[model samples]
Target: MSKHSVVIFVSQRNSLRSILAQACLAHLGSGRFLALSCGWPGMLADAIHPAAIGALNSASMPIPNHRPRDWNDLARPSAARAEFVITLDETTSSFQPRWPGQPDSALWAFPDVAAAGDPEKVAHLAIQMLYALRRRLELFVSLPLQGTDRAAIRSDLRDLAHMR
Candidate 1:
């Protein structure tokens, strides 16, 4: 039997974009992929953002049951090795750590919705990000990963970043 491909979503903070991506992939991957998420070292948030939780609840997606984690935790030798590592923000994309198996990596580049002060605005941005992530993840789960080479898969994921 074939094993599921493991994908990790990363961001400056695991509170918003990465969390949304992770939840969306977990829902859309259909047993073909294992999804996880983390934030940069020293940058993990105290909790998943309330806006993010509301967005997921509104969309009927599952909320992750864990707090934001440090990216360094995933770098440990005992950690699950990722097949792909995707950065959801510009900051994380610029400083991603090397994965154990040198997973195919890409930058999805979602904006920081946490920066918005107004509760309504934050919720709006969160939902928008969630929908955007869901669209990309739908395309992602449709990729022919079984027979594809590492380079080709990487290119395919990178190409998805160009979609609006």
Candidate 2:
């Protein structure tokens, strides 16, 4: 199997979606893939998003004290180049991004309704989006390199979700 590393960029580290993806990818496909998350140029290292951390913990995937990082640190010599970069934002330009190795990238718009705010509203907004992402992403990352069958991949995704 080919090793794939993805650089996931977000506006801030203190949030539901970005950390959720990082933890989920790391937990689900740890050996097969390398996953890291960053933010725009000056985003600070801060506490993990409360709602997000809770969401992940409830799902048995808690990730704590995630530091916000930038492309400079990432592009440093020792870091591996990301083969794919995915930006998660509801608006296209809400965050700054630079794709390494001219990698394939997509601006996936997702609701940040779980930002620092009231618990009920955030849960209603953020966790809902997380479920949606979990469904689509299972199918996405399951793609094989050559002659991969779409129907089989879908079945696999369904089974994987059930297992989760």
Candidate 3:
């Protein structure tokens, strides 16, 4: 059987943190999980943030196509529903959608690194987000997912999301 899938959400522009988490998990999960990302149809950006691209380059991970998509784009009739839905910001966490199975979800609130004025700060934040998501995803992919430990798994994910 195929492994469970994860979807990451970010509000507003789908250019930074959410995209990073999606790429990071896809790189680290190694087919253990499928990762997808989307954002609200608010203030869409024309492309992914340059700093995000830089961070991915620094990590030697290939950047996904610099496309920003909304949640509705992926919620079509035949799309594979997510088993876990991770919201990368506060705004997205509050805007709940009627996911088919009401998948397990969590909100990991990270700062808006792409909006930071300085390029240096933007790069720093990108790196920080990349590593943090990597750690959380590592934990997630290691869980005894087939065992009866749903509560513990949720708790761990919640704790990871709240980390500073």
Best by TM-score: 1
The 10-residue segment with the lowest total lDDT in model 2: 155-164
Give the Cα lDDT of each candidate: 0.89, 0.58, 0.77
Ranking by TM-score: 1, 3, 2
Ordered from best to worst lDDT, the candidate numbers read 1, 3, 2
RMSD from true fold, candidate 3: 1.8
- For 16-43, candidate 1 gives per-residue lDDT tens digits of 9999999999989888888999999888
- Residue-pair clashes per prediction, in order, are 0, 0, 0
Inter-residue clash pairs, candidate 1: none
The collision pairs in model 2 are none
What lDDT tens digits, residue by residue, belong to model 3 across residues 1-164?
23556555565678888888888888887777778877787666778888889999999877877598887776665667767778887866666566665677788888788888899999988998899888887887777766657787778777777665
Model 2 TM-score is 0.73
Local error of candidate 3 at residue 12 (angstroms):
2.8
* Each candidate: RMSD: 1.3, 5.7, 1.8
Which portions of model 2 miss their true places by more than 4 Å? 90-97, 146-164
Question: Which candidate, 1 or 2, would have the higher lDDT against the true structure?
Answer: 1
lDDT per residue as tens, model 2, 1-164: 24564545454443556677776777666456677766555554455666776677667865835565655666555667775556675443444545445555555566667554788778666666666666656655666733566456435533443322
Name the runs in model 1 displaced over 4 angstroms: none
